[model samples]
Every structure is written in C-alpha cells, then in structure tokens.
Target chain A: MQQTRTVELGTGLFVFLGVVALFFLTTQTTGFSGFMGGDAYRVTARFDNIGGLTTRAPVTMAGVTIGRVEAIEFDPERLNARVTMRIDGRYDQIPDDSEASILTAGLLGGQYIGLGAGGSFDNLRDGDEIYLTQSAIVLENLISRFLFQQSQEDQDD
Target chain B: MSVLRELGESFVSFLRILGDMALFLLRLVMYTPRGLLRFRLVVHQVHNTGALSLVIIMISGLFVGMVLALQGFDLLARFNSEDALGTAAALALIKELGPVVTALLFAGRAGTALASEIGLMKATEQLSAMEMMAVDPMRRVVLPRFLGGVIAMPLLVAIFTAIGIFGAWLVGVVMMGVDAGSFWSQMQANVSGDEIFEGVFKSVVFGIAASLIAVYEGYRAWPTAEGVGRATTRTVVLTAVSVLILDYMITAALL
Candidate 1:
C-alpha cells in the first residue's frame, strides 16, 4: 500500500510537470497568448506582387511589430493581391494616408509588411484600405534590369 | 508451386492479423469505461510508463536541442543573420522533431516493456488464471496499460519540446553569444497558434499508435519465451514505422 502511494505521488508530479511544459509551449513559444488577449482592428492593402508574404507574418511600424497579416487574397476586379492586416488595438493611431509596403527581413528571411507613418490627421479604421502600397521587389526583375542598363551603357560607350 | 502457395498463405495471415488487431482495439475501447472505474490500476501503469521514461526523454531532448542550436547558428551566421536562430530552432523542434522523437523513444522504452511484460504473463498462464477466476483480463490488465500510454505520451512530448527549447537557448544565447532579446522575440513573433496545435495533434495521434501497438502485440503473444521475445521486437518495429507514416500523413493534411 505504501509503495503504491509513492508511485501515485510520483505519477501526479510527472503529470503536473508535463502540463506546465505544455502551457509554456502554447503561451510563450507560440503566438497563442497574443491571439487570445489582445483586441485588434483590421485594415486592407493591395499590391501587384506580395512575393513570399504569408498569413501570420508580422506587420511592423518602425521595426516594432504592431500587428499580423490575417489573410492574403487575390482581388479579381483589380488583379492584385489584397492583404488584410489585424493591428493591435493599442496602435489605433496609424494615419489614414500611411504607406504599406511588403519588405524582406535580411537577405534570406521571410517577407513582412512594413507600415510607414503618413502626415495626416485621420487614422485608419476598420475596413479602410491604404491606397499607397508598394509591391515586393522581385530579385529576378532587379537583376535583369541591372543587366539591361549595363548593356545600354556599353552600347553608348 | 510450393513457393507461390507460401507467399499466398503469408498474405492471408497478414490480413487475419490486421483484422484481429482491429477487433482488439474495438474491445479495448468498449472496456475503457470499466478501466476508468479502476483508475488506480491506470495510475500504476502511468507511473511505470511516464515517470520511468522521464530521464531518457529529457536527456534526449536536451541533446537534440543543443545540436540544433549549434547547427542552426553555424548556418545562420554565414548569412550574418544569426538572430533568426531562435525562430529556426523553435520551429524545427516544435513542428517536427519534438513529437516524432518522443514517440520513437517511447516505443523503444515503454512499448517493449509492455509487450514483454504481457507476453511473460501469458507464458506463465497468469492471464488464463485471471480468466478462470471470472475476471476479464482485457478490462483488468490491458486497458489500464493502454490508457496509461495514451495519457502519458502527450505529456512526455510537451516536456521534451520545452526542454529542447531551453537547450537551444543555452547553446545559442549563452555559449554562442547570439542576442537573447531577438532570439526569443523573433520566435514569439513568428510561431503561430496553428503550428503549436499541429505539434500537439501529432503527439496525440502518435501516442495512440504507440500504445495500441504495444498492448496488441503483448496480449496476442504466443505463450512461450521465444514468442514473447519476438512480440517485443515486433512492437518496436511496427510502432516506429506507423509513427513515421502517420507523421507524414498528418503533416501533409495539416499543411
């Protein structure tokens, strides 16, 4: 009986430890905490090319992440990529005229949306679209353009 | 003609075994409520499987994490983007390595133990003795062991992942001098709830597979020493193959 009790006690401790680890993974390691606790507002932007921008990528202002890209959809009417962003409620003062651009993190890192603040009094509200948007820079396009410019320069020389 | 007949007979035997396993699983499920009522028995098995396996799981997790950090930092540093080490290591551990490795270890450690123990009981006629005494061995013995493995598996996976992340942090930030703030912050910013759910879901599925294979092999072992040994070996092999196949299927479905 005593041995059984000891075994049971050990099992209880093991189980408790496992639960704590699970809680840590969910709350700290993942974005589950932010998803559950924060209130956020949605805004839309359109780009000709989003590059490798994925859902759940960070939306940053001045290098600080302020929200997340909730969804990316194709605008059939405009023939562009429409991105929906969910900004944290605390950052509600983003100007209506701000520019949204898809930017890469470092050379090989994932793509994210960077919002540049505009000098307007009006703040962006839910469902409002940011009109000034820059598409992601395609590497192949840049390389080809560079080569084309080089050829022109050689011809002129 | 003899060789062709042998091949056909083997195939038929494989089908029969699969059918038998399915029925055994159904019976285990039916007796689960009764097994729950004997919760103490289940607890004992949990102690056997979970607590006993903790040291090995933790050590393996730590070493795996440390190795990931070392490899990740080396690769990321060449690009001058070592700050992404935390995100890379955490994603690899959480999404793939943690659950899969834990299930593999659990099968090797606990699965073989369950199979051999049950096989020995059959060899000694203890299971038959219980049957003659009017106690259902399925409910009394097998269900508790199966439930224990199923319950203990996810917990072990969780612990393994947590320990692995800590090991990565130790190697990345402490020893390698990676920026601590970026390491954690980047991981937090990048990893989503859905990815974590995928890991937990995989662990649960693997737990069921590992435990089921162990108990089924043990319960149906031929009542002899060589039979018990073969059953134990088969438990490990089958569980490993099923876990890997299931991991691929689950990842494909989720992704």
Candidate 2:
C-alpha cells in the first residue's frame, strides 16, 4: 500500500514538473505571458508591399519589441497590404508621425517592424493609423535594377 | 490472371485489417468508462509505463539538446550571430524534436512492453479465463494500460523538452562560453505561445496513436509465442511510422 502511494505521488510530481516545463515553454519562448492579460492597443499601417512580413512579427522601437503584428490583409482599393499591430499599453509614447518600416534582423533573418520616432509631441492613440510606412526591401529588385543600370551604361559606351 | 488474383487478395486482407482495427478501437472507447472504475489498475500501469520510462527519455533528451546546441553554435558562428544559438536550439527542440523523439522512444520502449505483455497473457489463456469467469478483459486489462500510456506520454514529452533545453544551455553557455543573457533573451523574443501549443497538441495526438496501437496489437495477437513477438515488433513499426506521418500532417496544417 505504501509503495502504491509512492507511485501515485511520483506520478503527481511528474505531472507537476511537466506543467512547469510547459509554463516555461510558453512564457520564455513567447512574448506574451498569462499574467499580462494582453493589455495592448491596436493600430494599423498601410504598405505598398509587405513582402514576407508575416503575422505575429515583432514591432520594435530602438531595438526593443513594443508590439507585434496582429494581422495582415490586402486593401482592394489602395492595392496595399494593411498590417494591424497590437502595441503594449506601456509604450504609448510613440509620436503619431513616427515611421513604421518592415525590416529583417540580418540579411537572411526573420522580418519585424522597426518604428522610427518622429519629431512631434502628438502621441499615437489606439486604432490610429501610421501614415508614414516603408515596405520590406526586395534584394532581387535592387540587384536587377543595378544590373539593368550597368547594362545601359555599357550600351552607352 | 494469377498476379491479379494475388493483388486482389492482398487488397482484401488490407481492408479486413482496417475493419478489425476500427472495431477494436470502438470496443476500446466503449470499455474506457468501465475501465476507469479500476483506478488501482490504471495507477499500477502508470507506474510501470511512465515512471519506469522516465530515465531513458531524460537521457535521450539531454543528448539531442546537446547536439542541437553544438550544431547551432557552429552554423551561427559563420555570421557572428552565435548569440542566437539559444533561440535556434530552443525552437528546434520545443517545436519539433522534443515531442517527436519522445513519442518514438515511448513506442520503442513502453509500447513494445505493453504489446508483448498482452500477447503473453493471451497466449497463456489468461484473457480467455477471465472471459469464461464472466469478466471483460477489455475493461479489466487492456483499457487501463492504454489509458495509463496516453496519460503518461505528454508528461514524458514535456520532461524531454525541459531536459533538452537545459542540455543546450549547458553546452552553449557553460561549455562554449556563449553570452547566456543574449541566448535566453533571443529565445524570449522569438518563440510564441502558438508554437508551444503546436508542440503539446502534436504530442497528445502521438500519445493517443502510440497507446492505442500498442494495446490493440497485443489484444489481437495470435495465441502463440511467435505471434506475441511479431505483435511487439508491429507495435513499434506501426507507431513510429504513424507518428511521423501524423506529425507531418499536423505541422503542415497548423504551421
């Protein structure tokens, strides 16, 4: 009977540890925690092309993540990608004129939104749209453009 | 004509196997409620399958984590982005390796044991004796073991992931002198709740598949020593392949 009790206790402990691991896995790996209750405000930005800017991409201000991309949709009339972002309530000091640009961490890393502070006292409110936006850089387009320019120069020569 | 007949026979046999497995699964689901009343038996099987399997799971997790850290470190060093090693290792383990490896290991270790044990009991006429005595072996025997296995699997996978992450930390930070703070911070910035949910959900599915296949193979094994051996082997093979296939399907659908 004691042995059976021990086994049961062990099973309980094993399950507890598993739950702890799961807690760590969720909190440590992800930006949000259970305690946060998602206290964030949503904002929107329009870009000519989002490129590989996936949903849930981080929104950073001065290298620190202040929000995340919540959703991405295409606006039919404007022919641009509409990106919805959820900014943490604590970082509400961002100016309305600030620029939101899609950027990669490295040359071949994941995409994120980099916010550049603008020279203004006007604070961005909830559901406010950022007008100044830059889309993701396409390397192929830049390279091809460069090659096309070089070929034109050679033809002139 | 003979070749076509052989093909037809094989196809019929395959359909028969599927039908038998489906009925067996239905019986299992029906008997589960009755089996839950035998709580002591379930506890005993949990002790046997889960508690006993912990050691192997931990060892494998640690090793897999260490190797991931080593490879990640090597690859990241090329671009001077060694600080991202932690993120890479953690993502690989939690998202993919942890649950899949744990399921594969569980199938080989506990799954085989469950199958062989049932097969042996069948061969010895134990199930038939219980039937003759007006007892349902499906409830008294098979269901508890299956339930215990299903309960234990996710826990084992969780432990594997935890140990594997620790192993990565040990190798990357302690052994190789990577900046521990950056490693952890990068991981926090990159990983999300959806990814962890995917991992856990995948393991739960794998657990059900592994446990059900193991018990079903054992219960249906022919009443002979060779049949028991074959059943155990089939339990391992079928569980492994199905786990991989399901993992792919789930990953494709979810990610």
Candidate 3:
C-alpha cells in the first residue's frame, strides 16, 4: 500500500513538472509578449459590423499590430461596434484622416482593426477617436456577391 | 452506372449520419449539467491522471527537448542561425509537440488504465451493482475522470514546456556552447503570451478527449472478459485519434 502511494505521488509530481515545461517551451517559440501594457498606444474605431472582433484582437498599421483591441461595445441607437485599441505608442501620430478597416490576419484568424495612414498633416493624439472605419467583409455576403457577379458576367459574355 | 450512383448516395448518407452524430454530441455537451464542479472528484482524478503520467511526461519531454536541440542545431547550423535553436525548440514544444506527445504517452498509459478499470468493473457487474445502489456512475466516475484529465493535461503541459525549454537551454547554452544570454533573450522576444495560451488550450482539450474516450469505452464495456480487452484497445485508439483531430481543429482555427 505504501509503495503504491509513493509511486502515485511520484507520478503526480512528474506530470506537474512536465506541463510547466511545455508552457515554457511554447512561449519561446512565438516572440510576441513584451512589456505587456507598455508596448502599444491606444485609440478607438467604430464600425457597423464588428463581426468576429474581440478584445485583445490585433490593431495593425500596415499589417503590423502596433496595438490591440482594448474594448468593444455596441451603441443601442447606432447599433455599431465601438472598438477601443492600444497601439504601440511610438508608432502614433497618424493624421486624423487615417482609415481603419477590419481585416483577417489569416483564413482562420478573427477580425482585427487595420489602420491605413492618411496624408493629413494633423496627427491623432492619445484618447483620439478614429472616425473613418470599415467593417469586416462578411464572408457569406462576399461569396453570394461573387456567385451573382459570375452569373451576370456569364450572361453578358 | 446505377450502382455507382447508389454508392455515391450511400457515401453522402454516411457523411450526413456523421454530421448528425456530431450535432448530437454538441447538444450533449451543451446540456451537460454543471456537475463538473465537484472539487473532491476533480481533485481525486487529477491526482490519478497526473500522478500516473508524471515520469513518462518528464522523461519524454526531456528527451524531446534534447532531440529538438540536436536537430535544430544541425538544421540551423546550415543557416548560421544556430542561435535560434532555443527559440525553435521552445515553440515546437509549447505549441505542437509537448501536449501532443505527452497526451500520446497518456493515451497509452492512464487512458489504458481508465478503460481497463472501468471495463473490468463493467465485466464484474460492479458498475451495474453501483447503478442498483442508486449511485450516479457518471457523476461518480466519468465526471471525476473527465475533470481530472482536463485539469491535469494543462498542468502536465506546463511542466513539459518548462522542462523541455530548460532542456533545450541546457543543450544549447552548456553543451553546444551557445551563449546563454542570447539563447534566453531571444526566447523572451519570440515566445508570445498568446502562443502559450493556444498551447494550453490545445492540451486541455486533448486531456478532455483522452478522459472522455477512456470513460466512454470503459462504461460501454460488455460483461465478457474479451469485452474488457476490446474496451482497452478502443480507448487507446479513440483517445489518440481524438487528440490528433482536436489538435488539428484547434490549431487550424487558433493559428
């Protein structure tokens, strides 16, 4: 009985240690976490449809996440998703006219707010709101639109 | 010609049947009472699954980490980027290999034990005896094992990652004479929090799958001794397959 108990305890310890090692191994593979809160600058963008947007989602400028989505909300009257973002503070000073479009990081990735720099001289300050926002291109809508256009083009041809 | 069409129809029918089964499973998961909150059962299962898996998890992780270091060093040496060996090993262990291999080890060990124990119980009419005694077998057996597996898998995954990374570090920094500072510093930059979360998520699911299959096969075991053997065999195969399937689906979406 004692031997069984001892063996069990030893096994439990081994499992515990192994899992800790696994996490350590993974964190080293993908180099993303820096000084968590210190890396990015914050801003807000609003959209009619956020779709799969969630907090902690990437806020990319020119396809690089200078920040992340901090919060998401829907206004009752407007029915639009109001997204707050924290961008890398150093990458700040985009002119107020910069456009934010929702984009997929990949085929399986959730939506992220992508910023396009504009030609305006005036730059966006911290706590500033980005007004020119484009929502996610809904996949179902795009598929239907493609099929309909294909049939139309066929008829025309 | 008619036979070909009939075969095609049958194939589609089979696929639709599988889809229906999947939907039922989804509903079953959805409707499962929050009975997973029994802390003692959870504790007991954790002790069982985790304890049973410790030595194998540790040794496997260690060797995998070492082998990764060796292979990574060999490959990266060609690129003169041998410095990235630590980071590469870390990522593979954390994201893909660690949980998967550990769960695979578990699919052979604790998973087999669980199936046999439950299978034997069924063969001996012990499970039926419990049912007659007004004992909720699912609550008493399945829930504990399932919860334990889910919790323990992640914990073991964490252990594997830590040890594996350290093993890589040892091989790279000490044995191979790679600079310790660069090896570790690069790791800090390359390994992201989100990746860790993804790894953890995968392992947890793997654990759940292993536990569920073990219990399911065991519980469904027939009264014969052969049934017990069949249950054990099925448990391992199903658990391993489930781990691979779950890994693919989760990683595909997460990435």
Candidate 4:
C-alpha cells in the first residue's frame, strides 16, 4: 500500500515538474523584437583600425548609441576597415562634414564609433560615406610609444 | 654547483608530479560514465556540494546585491546616471562577480568536505576493500562525487546570481529610493540571454574542475590521518587556484 502511494506521488511530482519546465523554456525567449527596432537609417563609416569593433557595437553621438554597427568589412586600397551602421532616423539632420571617430566605450573596453556633428546644412543619406573617420587608438601602440619617449628622455639624461 | 643540483632535483620532481596528475586525470575521464552506479555516485556528490551550499550562497548573494545597489546609488546620483543602476548592477553581477565569487565560496565550503570524506575513506583501506570486492571504486565512489559536483555547481551558481539581483533590487528600491519598476526595466533592457548563458557555461566547467581536484586528492590519500588532512588542505588550495586561472582564461576567450 505504501509503495503504491509512493508511486502515485512520484507520478504527480513528474507531471508538476514537466509543467514548470515547459513554462520556463517558453518564457526564456520573451521575443527578440525590441532588439532589432528599425527607426534607424543605415550608413557606412571607415577606419584604419577598427580594433575590436564587434557587430552590434554602438555608434554614438555625444556618447549615446545613435545606431549600431550592422556589418564590418575591410578595404585594401585605403588600408582601412569599413563599419556599416544603422543610425536612428531622428538624428538625420547630422551634417555631411561631421567627423566620425572610433572611440572606446571605457578604458580597456569595447570599441564604438562616435559622430561629431558638424553645423553644415548638407546632411548625409543612406549609401553616402562618412569621410572624416578616425581609427581606434591602439592601446599597445600607445604604451610602446610612451616607453620609447621615456627611453629617449632617459638617454638624454 | 649546489644550486644547479638542487634545481635539477626540483625539475625532475615537478615533472614526476605533472606525470602523476596527467595520468590521474586521464584515468578519471576515461573511467567516468560507465553505468547507473557511476551516475548515482555523481548525483550524490553534487547533492552534497551543491544542495548543501545553497543556504550560505543565497544569504551572501542577497546582502551583496542590496549593498551594491546602495553604494552604486550614491555614486550614480553624483553623475545623474541613477537610472542606469539596474543595468550596471545586472551586468557587473551576472557577467563577472556572480560565478567567480560563488565558485570560490563553494570551493571553500563543499570542496573541503569532499576532500576530507574521500581522504578518510582512502586512509581506512575501505577503498582497497571495495576494489578487492570488484566494486570498481572509481564508478562506485569517485565518479559520483565528480559528476555530482559538476551538475550541482552550475545550479548553485545560478541560484546565487538570481538571489543577488533580487537583493540588489530590494536595496535599490527600499533603501536608496530607486524606483523598482525602473530597476527591473533597465535590467530587462541590458542583460542579454547570451550573457547569462555564458556565465552558466563557465560555472559548469568550473564545477567539473573543482570537483575533480578535491575528489581526486582525497581518493589517492596515504594510509594516515595526517595524509587525509593534507589532502583536504590541498583540495581547497588547488580548487581556489584552478578557479582563478579558469576565470582568467574564459574572460580572455570571451573578449
């Protein structure tokens, strides 16, 4: 009788668990719509060194993600990496002469593109290239430069 | 001349230690997953290490979350970035601190216990008797604890991380006066499912490594109480070292 009761209880427990697992598995996704919102216009910006420029990396204007990098490609002639970005439609008035610099999110962190909006009335459109682009400040390069300068100073001393 | 000879001796000793460790690891990996006996042993070990450590982890997690929110509130308010508290807390807690610290704590608490238990079993000749009885001690004993630790370790880490975020919310809303809605909403906005999966993946691997080290040391203990004691001490030390090393390697790979 006890064994029969235990078996029944176990069956009930398994059913309960199956229900809970289903709920958790279904609930896990929560839809991926907000992630790919499209009130943004896609544009291209090229850099000599995009160092760690990941897909979906932020494109910033005044440190806000005006858009995100949609894709990255290499240009052998200009010796640069081109970042294609999707920027918010609201920021369409940004001048064509605006500077785009590849910036670090924080010290020793991910790379992002920063747009310095110019006052020129001529604004950019899709497929128009951002001309004034700055490459990422390579950290190792900077450290080596600093060390070389210091050694030069030491030699003079 | 003496220094060179001493260096030579140490190098040979190191190589011998490495060979032993490699052989043990190879044998353990090969011998695992034989049948039900092996499976049960793994589950039992995981229950001991993981289920046992849940209370301590939860309490620690809860308080830490609250304190972080409070501390972060003051700093963020100075820059008017208080709205970002939840995002910051979730990213920092889930991505980095959650798994690493929990693993360290678990290593100290349960890893020590595993080592001591196995060491005692070895010192008493009970392990040898099981071997003589054709019980296959690896399947009957070691594999169970190793597998159990691996399974339980990740689950425990997840529990700790969840409690921590909840704790952070409690402190953020009640103490620091951040709106609860905003906190949760920001968390939803920033903390990706991928990030959470990555953290869990790391913890699972950490669990397997930690359990193997602790259990292996204990299973091979010398036939003395002192030897058993030595094994426990080594387990804690080795587990902690290995956890830190693995954490660095994973972060580098992810980056």
Candidate 5:
C-alpha cells in the first residue's frame, strides 16, 4: 500500500509538470493569448499587391507590434488586394489618415504591415478603412527596373 | 516459379498479421471502459511508464536543443541573421523534433518494458491463471497499461519541447553572443498556435500507436522464453518505423 501511494504521488507530480510545460509552450513560447475576437477591433486597408503577406503576420507601428493581420482577400471589384487587420483595443488612438505599408523584416525575412501615424485629429475606429496604403515592393520588379535603367545609361554612353 | 510462390505466401502472411492486429485493437477498445473503472491500476502504470522515463527524456531534449542551436547559428551566421535562431530552433523543435524524438524514446524505454513484462507473464502462465479465475486479462492487464501510455505521451512531448527550447536559450543567449531580446521575441512573434497544435496532435497519435503495438505483441506471444524475447524486439522495431511513417503522413496531411 505504501509503495502504491508513493507511486501515485510521483505520477501525479509528473503529470502536473507536463501540464505546466504545455501551458508555457502555448502561452509564452508561441505567444498564443487565447481568442483575439473580443479584445481587438478590426480595420481594413487596400493595396495594389500583397506580395506574400500572410494572415497572422504582425501589424507594427514604428517597429513595435500592436496587432496582427486577420485576413487577406482579393478585391475583384477594385482589382486590388484587401487586407483586414485586428488592432489591439488599447491602441485606439491611431489617426484616421495613417498610412499603412507592407514592409519586409530583414533582407529575406517575412513581410508585415507597418503603420505610420497621421496628424489628423480624427481617430480610426473599428470597420474603418485606411485610404492611404502602400503596396509590397517585389524584388523581381526592382531588379528588372534597375537592369533596364543601367542598360539605358550604357546606350546613352 | 518457386520464388514467385514463396513471395505470394509471404504477402498472404503479412495480410493475416494485419487482420489479426486489427481484431486485437477492436477488442482492446471494447475493454477500455471496464479498464477505466480500475483507475488505480492505470495510475500505477503511468508511474511505471511516464515518471520512470522522465530523466532520459529531459537529458535527450537538452542535448538535441543544444545541437540545433550550434548548427543553426553556424548556418545562419553566413546570412547575417543570427537573431532568427530562436524562431528557427523553436519551430523545428515544436513542429517536428519534439513529438518524433519523444515517441522514439518512449518506444525504446516504456514500450519494450511493457512488452517484455506482459510477455513474461504469458510465458509463466500468469495471464492464463487469471483467465481460469474468470478475470478478463484484457481489462485487468492490458487496457490500463495502454491507457497509461496514451495519457502520458502528450505530457512527455510537452515537457520535452519546453526543455528543448530552454536548452537552446542557454546555448544561444548565455554561451553564445546572440542578442537575448531577439532570441525570445522572434520566437514569440513567429511561432503560432497551429504549429503547437500540430505537435500535440502528433504526440497523441504516436502514443496510441506505440502503446497498442507493445500490448498487442506481448498478448499474442508464443508463451515461451524465445517467444517473449522476440515479442519485445518486434515491439521496438515496429513502433519506431510506424512512428516515423506516421509523422511524415501527419505532416503532409496537415500542410
């Protein structure tokens, strides 16, 4: 009986440790803070090209993340890409005229939306769309353009 | 003609074993509810399988994580993006290595023990003795151990992953000159809930497969010393191959 009790206690401890580890993985390491629906408000932006922007990518202001991209869809009516972002409720003072731009993190890192605050007195609210938006810069387009300009310069010479 | 006949016979035997395993699994599932009633026995088996195997799991996780950091740093330094080490290491550990490695270790540690123990009991006629007294050996013996393994597996994987990340942090931040802030923040920013779910889901599937194979092999052993030895060996070999194959299938399906 004593041996059985000891075994039971040890098993209980092991299970408890396992649960703690799981909690840490989900909450701290992965940064999953449960459902985001209630604590955040949605805003929309339109860009000419999204260029590998994925849902759940960070939405940052001055390099500090304040929200995440909730959805990306093709705007067939406008012939552009529509992006929906969920900004944290605490950051409710974003100006109505703020510029939203898709930017890459490092030279080859993933892309995220970077928001530049505008000076307008009006604050953006949920369901509001930012009209001033910049699209993602495609590397291939930049390279081809640079090559074309260099060839033109050589021809002139 | 003789070689073709031999190949056909082997194929038929393979199908026969597969069908037998399926029937055994069905019987095991049917007895599971009755086995739950004997919860104390299940807990004891959990202690035997889970707690007893904790040290090896932790040590192995630490070493694996350390190696990943060392290799990852060297590879990423060429690109001048060593700050992404945390994200790289954490994602690999959480998405792939954690569940797969832990399952392999579980097969080697607990699976063999369960197989050999049950095999020996059959060898000595202990299981038959219980049957003579009207106790269903399936419920009294097999189901508790299986349930214990299934319950303990996710927990073991979770612990292994967490320790692995810590080991990476120890090497990348403390020993190496990588920036500590980026090490953690990069992981938090990039590692999502879906990847963690994938790891947990794989662990559960692996747990069921490993446990079921171990008990099935032991229950159907030949009731002799040589038979028991062979059963234990088969349990390890079968569990390892199936876990890896299942890992690939699950990853492909999830992706």
Candidate 6:
C-alpha cells in the first residue's frame, strides 16, 4: 500500500513536469500567448513586394513582438502584396499614420514586419490599413541593378 | 515447388497476424469505456511504464541536445551565425528529434517489458485463471497497460524536448562563448506553435501505435518462454518502423 502511494505520487510529479514543459514550449515558440490571452487586434498593410514574407511570421514594434502575420494575398488592382497582421491589444496605442516596414532580423535571419510609430494622436483600429509601407529589400535585385548601372557607365566612357 | 510453398506460407501468416492485430485492437477499444473506471490499475501501469522510464528519457534528451548544439554550432560558424545555435537545437528537438527519439526509446524500454510481462502471465496460465474466475484479463491487465503507455509517451517526449534545449544551452552558452541572450531570443522569435504542435501530434500517434502493438503482441504470444522473447522482439521492431513511417507521413502532411 505504501509502495503504491509513492508510485502514484511520483507519476503525478512526472506528469506535472511534462505539462509545464509543454506550456513553456508553446509560449516560447509562437505568438500563441497573445492569441490565447485574447488580447490582439487585426490590421492590414500593403507593400509593392513582400519578397519571402510568410504567414505566421512575427510582427514587431520596436524590437518586441506584438503579434504575427495572419495572411498574405495579392492585390491585383494595386499590383502588390497585401499582408494581414494581428497586433496585441496591450500595444493599442499605435498611431494611425505609423509606417510598417519589412525588416530582416540579422544578416541571414528571417524577415518580419516592423512598425515605426507616427506622431499622430489617431490610433489604428481593427481592419485599418497602414498605407505607408516598405517592401523587403532583395539583395539580388540591388546587386543586379548596380551591375547594370556600372556597365552602362563603362559603355558611355 | 518448395520455394513457392514457402512464399505462400509466409504471406498467409502475415495476413493472419494482421487480422489478429486488428481484432485485438477492436477488443481493446471496446473494453475502454468500462476499463477506464479502473483508475488505480491504470496508475499502477503508469508507474510501471512512465516512472521507470524517466531516467533513460532524460539521459537521451541531454545527449541528443548536446550533440545537436555541437554540430549546429560548427555548421553555423561558416555563416557567422553561431547565435542561432539555440534556435536550431530547439527547433530540431521540438519539431522532429524529440518525439522520434522518445518513441524509439519507449519501444525498446517500456514496450518490450509490457509484451514480456503479459507473455509470462499467459505462459503461467494466469490470464486463463482470471477467465475461469469470470474476470476479463483484457480489461484488468491489457487495457491498463495500453492506457498507461499512451499517456506516458507524450509526457516522456515533453521532458525530452525540455531537457534537450537545456543541454544545448549548456554546451553553447556555458562551454563555448556564444551570447546567451541571442540564443534564447532567436529561439523564441523563430520557433512557432505549429512546430510544437507537430511534435505533440507525432508523439500521440506514436504512443498509440507503440502501446497497441505492445499489448497486442503480448496477448497473442504463444504460451511458451521462447514465444515470449519473440513477441518482445516483434514489439520493438514493429513499433520503431511504424513510428518512422508515421513520422514521415505526418511531417509531409503538416508541412
């Protein structure tokens, strides 16, 4: 009987540890905390080119993640990528005129949308679109354009 | 004529085993609603499987994580991105390595024990004795073990993943001079819920496969010592192969 009690206690502790680990893993890995806490709002942005931007990518405001990219679609009439973002409710003070730029984390890290606040008192609400947007800077395009310009200059010389 | 006869014999046996396994699974499921009422028995088997298996799971997690950190750091050095070592290790452990390794370990550890224990009882006629007493051994013995294994597997995998990340941190931040802040922050920023869910889902499927095979093999083992050994071996082999195949299928579908 004593042995049984000890075994049950041990199993309980083991299971508890496992649950804690899983909760830590879930919170650490994703923007799930914001969604699970029910404290996020949706907004949209339009860029001329999103490059390799993917759905579920983090949306950061001043280095801190506010939420994630919910979806990406092509706007045929505007000829650009339309990105839907979910921002945390706690950070609701984002000005309506704020700029959203696609930025890379490091030299080879993944790209995310970063928000630079504007000086306006008007705040962004759900479904509101941020018009001031910059697309991902494709290094290959810049390099090729630079090469083309140099060759043109050489021909003129 | 002999070669053809042998091929035919093997194929027939294969189908027979498959049929028996399917029926065993059906019976197990049928017993579940009532068997679940025996919570103490399930807890006993949990002790037998989960508690006993913790040491091995933790040891494997640590070593796998250490190896990942070392190898990842070497590879990332070329790109001058050693800071992503934590992310690489965490992602690998959470997404693929943790569940796969834990399931393989469970097959070798708890799975074999389950098969052999039931085989021994059958050989000793204990199961039959229970039947004579009007007690269904399938519910009293088999169901508990099955539920125990299924419950134990995901917990084991969770522990494996957590320990693996810590191991990676030890090797990356404590031993080699990588920035601790970057390692964790990058891991946090890149690792997502979908990847974690992928691992959890894989483990659940593996748990079901491993436990079902273990109990099925045990219950059906020929009532002999040698038969018990063979059944145990079969449990490990079948569980490992199916887990790998299922891993591939799940990863492909999820990704």
Using TM-score as the measure, which candidate wins? 5
* Candidate 4 deviant stretches above 4 angstroms: A1-54, A58-68, A74-81, A84-157, B1-11, B35-38
Query: Candidate 2 chain B — worst ten consecutive residues by lDDT sum?
Result: B186-195
Per-residue CA lDDT of model 6 for A104-153, tens digit only, reads 88887899999999998999999899989999999899999999999999
lDDT, candidate 5, A1-157, per-residue tens: 8998899889999999899999999998876466465578999999999998999998999988889999999988999999999999989999999999999998757899999999999999999999999999999999999999999999999
Tell me, by lDDT, which candidate is best: 1
Model 3 TM-score is 0.65
CA deviation > 4 Å runs, candidate 5: A35-37
Q: Tell me the number of clashing residue pairs for each predicted model.
A: 0, 1, 42, 5, 0, 0
List DockQ, one per candidate, in order: 0.78, 0.61, 0.28, 0.07, 0.80, 0.68
* Rank ordering of all candidates by TM-score, starting from the highest: 5, 1, 6, 2, 4, 3
Q: Give the per-residue lDDT digits (tens) of candidate 5, residues B66-139.
A: 99999999999999999999999999999899999999999999999999999999999999999999998888
List of clashing residue pairs for candidate 4: B41-B144, B42-B144, B42-B148, B46-B148, B65-B168
Over A19-44, each residue of candidate 3 has an lDDT whose tens digit, in order, gives 54554444455444564457556678
Q: Give the per-residue lDDT digits (tens) of candidate 1, residues A64-144.
A: 888889999998998999999998888999999999999998776789999999999999998999999999999999999
Please, what is the whole-model Cα lDDT of each candidate in the order they appear? 0.93, 0.89, 0.76, 0.74, 0.93, 0.91
Runs in model 6 with CA error above 4 Å?
Answer: A28-32, B1-12
lDDT per residue for candidate 4 within A41-153, as digits (tens), equals: 87888888887778877678987667778899998888778889888787888899899998875442468789999888999887778989988888899999999999999
Q: What tens-digit string does per-residue lDDT give for candidate 3 at B39-129?
A: 6556667777887677777778788888899888888888777777767887798889988998888888788888888888888887788
As a whole number from 0 to 100, the lDDT of residue B90 in candidate 1 is 92
For model 1, residues B1-255, the per-residue Cα lDDT tens digits are 999999999999999998999899899898898789988999999999999999999999999999999999999999898999999999999989999999999999999999999999989999999999999888888999999999999999999999999999999999999999999988887788888899999999999899999999999999999999999999999999999999999999999
In model 5, residue pairs whose N, Cα or C atoms come closer than 3 Å (at least 3 residues apart or on different chains), thus clashing, are none
On DockQ, the candidate that comes out on top is 5
Q: Quote the chain B TM-score of every prediction.
A: 0.97, 0.96, 0.87, 0.91, 0.98, 0.96
Instruction: Specify the poorest-scoring 10-residue window by lDDT in model 1 chain B.
Output: B185-194
What is candidate 5's CAPRI-style docking category based on DockQ? high
DockQ-based ranking = 5, 1, 6, 2, 3, 4
